[model samples]
Every structure is written in C-alpha cells, then in structure tokens.
Target: MDSGIITILLPLALAIIMVGLGLELTPRDFSRVGKHPKAVLIALFCQLVLLVGIAFVICKVLALPPLLAVGLMLLAASPGGSTANLFSYLFKGDIALNISLTAINSVIAAFTLPLIVNFSIQYFMNDGQQISLQFSKILQVFSIIIVPVCMGMLIRHFAPHLTEKLNKPLRIFAVLFLILIIVGAIIKESHQIMSYITQVGLATVIFCICSLMIGYFVPRLLGINSAQARACAFEIGIHNSTLAMTIALTVMANSAVAMPAAIYSIFMYVFAAIFGTLLNRFSRDDVSSRTTSPT
Candidate 1:
C-alpha cells in the first residue's frame, strides 16, 4: 500500500518471480514453438485477439469504471506463467507445449500488453484521465519482464547446479509474493473493495470461463490433439496476474486498476482446476469408448 513498496519492493518481487520463470526455461523452450506452430498460433490468437475482444465487450457491457476496465484489459494481456505448466502436467497436457507457449507469450506481451492497456485507457478512460503507458513506461514494462528472464536463463545456462538450488525457493517465493500483492491491493482499496468486486466480479468470472473454453475448444476444432489442446487451454486460461497487478500499482500507480487482477487471481485457480477435472473425465470417456468399440 505504501508508495515505497509499490515503486520499489513490488517490482523487485516481480523480477524475482520472472527470474524463476527464466530458470525453468532454456533456449529450447523458445525453439520448441516451431515444432508445434499450430498450437502456438492458435493459443496466441485466443490470447491476443479473441480474449482481448471478450474483455473489451465485458467492460463495455458491464459499464465498468475506467480504471477497472483498464485493469481487466491489463489482466487479459498478461501471459501465462510457470503455474500454467504445473496445471498442464497435472491434467496430462503437453508440458513442452505449455513451456513453449509461456516462453513465446512472455516476449510478445512486452509489446502487446502496453498497446492493449494504452488503448483501454484511451477508450474507457474518456474522463480526462492522464494515465497512459507512454514510450518510457513501455520500456520499463519491457525491462521488468525481459531482463530478469534473460538473467535467469543465463544463470541456468552457466550454473546448472545453482539454478537447480534456486528453483524451488524462487517458486515458493513467487507464490507468496502473489498472495501478498493481492492482499496489499485489497488493503489499499479496502473501502472500495466490495464495490469494486460487485462491479468486476461477474466480468472476471465470465471472462475466466470463456478463456478456458475458448482456449481449449478453438484449438480442438482446429485439429489440435487433446493433449496439446489441454495445454493451450491452461496456457490461455491462467494469466500472470502478478505482472498485471505490479504494472497497475507501480507503472500506472492506481490501486483501482489492480483490482481486477487481484480478484481474478482468486477465482482463476479454482476455475482452472474444475475445468481440468472435466477435461480429464471426458478424456477418459473418450478412451473408454474407443477401447470398447468393435475392433
């Protein structure tokens, strides 16, 4: 809640988390995208295009306040993180594909996130608000995201044993940092927390459901196999809310603009678990049907 924490500590925490992400990644993770170009392209389409459109519609239809609308747009723009890879592994999705998508999305988001958030600010904040991700702020976003990742990648490349030692501790820290940020955002906006939730809750829930569905179904319909489709689903479904919140609190310096991501973080894991369970059930049934059919 403090400006000191917002400007300094929050970004430092995020850099550590991004470094953890990089520790998990390697050069191969980026190159692997070439092997599953369809899955990658389809997931990106859903993430960058369809889901962004969906968030805009939800914002307009719900008549969200300007800051909240921009927050939702920011959340929609965030890339999937290491958490998505865990979900993919649990649900029997293509873990390699998840890693590839995460690797690619993180890079692309440095550019796309600023554009989307700036557009949302212009369109939704027609009330003469001065918040915009101008060129310098865009560079800040780029550095916050890419530099730590590159650092982690280099550490892993150069010192394999140190990377291994840092992995678990960083992962734990990332989770703790996320929880702290969400609580801090709520505390900062305590007076308006409930009001903000009432305004943005349904939009976030609907957006989450739509994200999971579109992430999976669109890929499936396009002839991607079930494993890869599940990977696509989780990758698109689980956004890097910490990144959104950090950018909101620090970059835009608005607690209201962080609320959507904070609230969405509460629901995303629950909804993702339920969705993954349903996918597993249906997958088993499909397998049973095939095994039982005349041969």
Candidate 2:
C-alpha cells in the first residue's frame, strides 16, 4: 500500500474495528462488572497499572529507541479484544468475564491510552523528536477512539439486525487491516526493521509472557477462581494491537512509533496460545487428580 493510502486507511480501518467491538458489547457487559467486582478490579489493575509498568521497565532495561519505547507504551495501553474471549473459551476460562473485561477495558482505554502515550513521548522523545500530543491533539485522539465506539454501540442498540450482519465482516477486516498496518510500518522502517526487531523482539515476547502470568496469578492469589484467572490471563495478555497500531500510525502520524506494536502483535498471539494451552493442561491435571482422589 502507498503511504497516502495507509494514512487514510489507518483511521478508517480502526473505526470499523472499534465499531465491531461495540457491536459485541451492550449495557449488560458493563453492568456485569458489578457482579464480579473483585475479578474486574484485579484485572483492570493488572492491565492499567501492572502491565504498563512492566512495559516501561522492559523499554528502559532493553534501552529501546524513543519511538519504539513510545510504541511499547501505546501497546500497553490498548485494551483487550474479542480474541481474548475466544482464547478464554478454548482454554476453559470464564468467557463471560472475558467479555466484560474487554468491554470495560475498551471504555477505559479511550482515556488512558492518550495519557500513557503522551507521557512516553515526553520521556523518550524529548531530545529533538517532533512528535508530541498537545492538549488538543489528546482530545482528538480520544475522539478518534471513543466516538466510533459510541456510534457502533448506538447502531447495535437501535439496529441490531444490521449490526449482526456487519459484525463478522468487520471483524475479518479488522484482522486483515492489522496485518497490513504491521507490514506497512515494517516496510516504512525497513532500513531499521532488523534493528527494531533485535531491540524489541525479546522484550515483546517477555512482556507478553509476563502479562499472561500477572493476569492469571495476580487474580488467583487474590482468591479468584482458576476459570476466572484464565479469563483474566487472556484478557490482560492479548492486547488490542490493532488499536495501538492505528493510534501510532494515524493519530501520532509516526510509523517509527508503530513498530513496537507491530512486532508485539507478531509475538502475542503465539505466546498467548502457548500460555492458554499450558493453563488448560494444568486445569485438566487438577481435575483428574481430584477425580481420582477419595473425595
């Protein structure tokens, strides 16, 4: 794709993806959080606080370039996605909980994504980089994320049939667009692509594994059930990389800042699948042992 086409398609594709997300959500998804406040709260803490902190530490420890560091932070800020629910279902997690977390996280990310990305820009890109989200630009970023979501919600509310028809195609488009964006970003920085991957590849893989671990163990340690922990694991682990990439490419207008998310996207699905499989095996073992015991 040409740079001009990518520039136009990036935001447009993101809006379609957000609309697909909204179509999956309803008022009940948000309200469901009240039914499992502890799980919800713990998951959010892991996502918004713990995961972001972990990414920052990885960036600093790995000594990532400024744009890549900002990309990592942006990826950290992106919410969970429908893929989390799918992984949760396959791994015997509480799918309802995954859906609820994804819904609430999407809403929360509209505000937090801008803040985290801006902070990263200030901290990492301050030397001479011309990229920064001013106050007005912050609002623009928020609008780009939140407005389409709200519009989709309204469509789902008022025109459920149409939403149902559009949902699957939009989801397919979302996945395709994500791949194209990642490729575009990589190609844009092809001269430095190898270096970016060298600096970011291990950090992204480690961050993904850590995310799944923290999402599961943190909630489990707090006495949440294993099923719920599995849900949290995928929810916290499988971030909306498409959203992060869109913001980096479209909102920030910086392909360099999109690199981390692009790289992380490549690793996250593979890692999450492995993590979910391990969790499933453990769950089966626990069940088998219990069933065999004289209980």
The clash numbers for all candidates, in the given order, read 0, 0
Q: Write the per-residue lDDT of candidate 2 for residues 141-178, one digit (tens) a residue.
A: 77777788888889999999999899889878888887
Instruction: Give all TM-scores, in the order shown.
Output: 0.98, 0.95
Cα lDDT computed for each candidate against the true fold: 0.94, 0.86
Worst 10 contiguous positions by lDDT, candidate 2: 1-10
- The candidate maximizing TM-score is 1
Report the C-alpha displacement of residue 183, candidate 2, in angstroms. 1.3
lDDT of 1 by residue, 122-147 (tens): 89887426588889999999999999
Candidate 1 backbone collisions, by pair: none
